[model samples]
Target: MIELAAIATEQRNPRSRHIDQVSTEEMVRIINREDHLAASAVEAIIPDIAKAIDLISGHLHDGGRLFYVGSGTSGRLGVLDAAECPPTYSTGPDLVQGLIAGGESAMFRAREGAEDDESLGKKDLLDKGLTEKDVVVGLSASGRTPYVIGALTFARQRGAATIAIDCSPHSPVGACSDIDLCAMTGPEVITGSTRMKAGTAQKMILNMLSTGTMIRLGKVYGNLMVDVKATNHKLEERARRIVMTASGCSRDEAIRALGQSKGQAKPAIVMLLLHISYEEAQKRLQAADGFISRTLTTASTEKGIR
Candidate 1:
C-alpha cells in the first residue's frame, strides 16, 4: 500500500464528523466554515506564491514557456488557467500549457490509474520538448501523486524551473520541486476527498501565479487587461471600455483608436493618451517593452525636453 494514512489531506475532519446526519443547512454551514480555512491556508503561503510569480515572470520574460502538469481536478484547474491566459493577455497558445496524466481525455473523465504511472509524467514532458528555458508546475493536492513527482523530477533534470502546488506539508511532490507551494488546507469534509478545500487553495494560488506573472510581464495597465484579445463581441466591448478608462476618452473616440490599432486596447490607449498615430503608439509601446505606463512616462519626458 502507498501509506496514505500519514497524509493530512486523507484524514477526517472533526467539525464535519456528523455531517451525514446533520440538517442540510447545518451541513452547508459546516462546509462553508471549512471553506474559509482554504483561503487562510493560501494566505499563509503568500510569500512562497509571490516567489513563484517572480520566478515564472522572469523566465517568461527571457523567452521561456510555462507548463502545468497534474491529474484529475488538479489537471483540470491547470488547463483552465492556461486556457484563460491567451484571451486575457493576448499571448500565444504555446506560451502557457497544461498536461494531464491520460492526456486530453483524462481532463473530462477520471483516469485514476493513469496517475500512478510515474513514467507517464516524464514521457508527457518529453513530448512537449522540455527545455531548460521552460518552467513546469506540478499540481497534486495530496502531495504524493506519482504523476506529479515524475513530472517535477523530469523538469528538474531537464534544467527547467520546477514548482509544486500541494495541500499537504512536506509532500513527496514538494520534495521534487525547486519552489514548494504547500498550502496546508487540512482535511476535507468528506474525508479523503481533497477536491474540497485543497482544490480551492490550489485554484487561488494558481490565480495568483498566472495573474501576477501577466502583470509583471506588462500584460496589464492600471489594473486593466490592456492586452486582452477581443475575440468575442463582449471582449470587443471590454477592450473599448479599457481604452476609454485608461485614456479618459469618449466611447466614440475609444472605438476610433481601437479601429486604428486593430482592436488592441494597449496601443489604442497609448494613441489616445499621447495624441499619436497608431504606428507611433506601437513604436512607443515596443520601445517601452509593452508597458503603457512606461510608454506614457517616456513620452511625457520627451515632450518636456522639447
Candidate 2:
C-alpha cells in the first residue's frame, strides 16, 4: 500500500534515462558526477549530525552504549562501522553494536523480506538488553523501513535516546527518533538502487558519527588514534609510530615507552613526554579522563606550581 513513486529514492532519474545506451566511460562519469552530490546532501544536514554526535557522546561518557539498527545495505554499513571501532579506538565490543533485520546470516545473503516484520526489530533490541542509558541509531535509505521504525519506537519507549539516518526528508524513521539526519541524495543513478548514492551518504554519515564520538571521548590525540589496539604486527608498528609522533621521541624510546606502558600508545606518549613512570602515567591519564593532552597539561601546571 506504500506509494513508491512519491519516495525520492524510488523516483526515476531523468539524468540516467539513457544510461543503458551510454558508453562505458560515460557511464562511469555519470555515476561519479552523481556521487558528488552525496557529500553536498550530507553537508546540508551538518547541524543535525552534530546534535546526534553530542547526544551519543554524552551517553557514552555516562557508560551508555550505542546501537545501530537497520536492514540490508544500511544494516551492513552500521555493522561495519561498529566492528571497526574496537580496533580503531580500543573500545570494548559492548560499547557499540549493530542489529540487522535478518540477523548475522543476512549480512552475507540477502534477506529482503525480513525488513517488513516490525516485531523482529524489537526482538533484536530486547536480545541485546537495551537499557535507558543506551542510544539507538536507525538507518533506512527509504525512511519507511518497518524494521528501523520499530527499533526506534522501542528505543524511545525504553527511555533511550534515538537517532535516525535516512535519505528522504521527514521520513517515518526520522519521526520516531529524537534526532533526524536526512541527507536527501535524491534518486539513484539506477533509479531505485539506493545502494549507490544513498549507501555512500550513509557510510559518510556513519563515519562522522562514530569518528566524532570517539574523538570527543578522547580516543584521539592530535588526530592520532592514541587508543589503537595493537593486536596485529602492523598495528603494533603504528602504535609505536603514534607514540613517537605524539611525544617527539625516537623510535627506540617510543618502543621502550610502549613496552613500559604495555603497548598502550596514549600512556606511552604520556610516559615519555612527562618523564614519568608507567604507573604515574597511568594515574595521570586516569585523572585526566584518558585525554593524553589534558594529562600532559595538568602535569606541566602542577610542576610549575611546585
Candidate 3:
C-alpha cells in the first residue's frame, strides 16, 4: 500500500488543524471556507477539461460510447452523472456508462479493498466491450487508485481516448490518459477525507464534460434541454414548458404540438415554430443532425416559415 501521508489529498489542512476544538458554528464556517478552494482548483484545469469534452463529443458523434471508471465516492459520482444523461438529454443507456471497482453492490457501501485489485478494473472494462471508438474517463482523487489506473491503461492499449480527472498533481492516472484534468484541491479539512473537496471537484468536472458534450451534440436548444425524455409526469410537464419557452407559443398550442409530436420537446417546438406537420419537423430534425437551431434557421431561410 502507498503511504497515504505522502499524498496531497491525505495531508492535513493548515487552516483546519484545530477544527475539533472549535464550536459547531466555527467548524461549519471553517469547512465551508475551505470548500471554496475546490472551485478555483477546477477552474485552473478548464483547458484540459475542454479538451476531454471535445474528444468525447467527437467520439460520441461518431457513434462511440463514453465510460467512467473509478472507486468509492469518485465512482458514485460518475455513476450519478451517467444515469442522469439519459433523462436529461434523451440519450441511450449505452451512450455513457460508469464502472466502479466492486460492481453495483459497492455503490451503496464502501468497497475499499476492491480498489486495490488492479485486474478487476481491466476486467470490468473488457466486460463492457470497450472499443477503439470509445472514450474512457478515469476518476481518482489521489490519482493512484489501482483500479482506475488499470482501466485507463487498458483503455489506451485498446486505442480508445482516455481522460483522467484527479485532485492531485503529477498523478499516475494523468500519465496514462490522453487528457488529464488534475484539479489541485489541496488537502481535505478532515485529513484524507477526499469525499469532501476532491469529490466536489470531480463532480464539477464531470458535469462540464457531459453537459458540454450534450450541447455540442445538439441535445440543448437555447439553454433548455430540448431532448429531455418525458418518461414521468414531472418530465412530461417539463417537456410542455420547454416547447412553450422555445416556440413562444401559448400553453394550449404547446400542449397540442407536444401531443402531435408524441411528447417530444424538440419536434413539438419545431413543429409549432415552423407551422409544419410532425412528420416534416421530424425529417428536418433528422436532416439537421438533431440540432433544432440549425433546422429552424434553415427552414426559415428556405421556406420563409416563421
Question: Could you tell me every candidate's TM-score relative to the true structure?
Answer: 0.99, 0.99, 0.98
Between candidates 1 and 3, the TM-score winner: 1
| Number of backbone clashes in candidate 2 | 0
- Position 284, candidate 1: lDDT: 93
lDDT of 2 by residue, 89-143 (tens): 9999999999999999999999999999888888999989999999999999999
| Regions of candidate 2 where Cα sits further than 4 Å from its true position | none
Which 10 successive residues of model 2 have the least lDDT summed? Answer: 291-300
Q: For residue 173, what is the lDDT in candidate 2? A: 96
Residues 1-306 of candidate 3: C-alpha lDDT, one tens digit per residue: 668888899998999999999999999999899889999999998888888889999999999999999999999999999999999999999999999989999999898999998889899999999999999999999999999999999999999999999988888999999999999999999999999999999999999999999999999999999999999999999998999899999999988998899989999988988889999999999999999999978987887653
Pairs that clash in candidate 1: none
Count the clashes in each prediction. 0, 0, 0
lDDT of 1 by residue, 171-227 (tens): 889999989999999999999988899999999999999999999999999799999
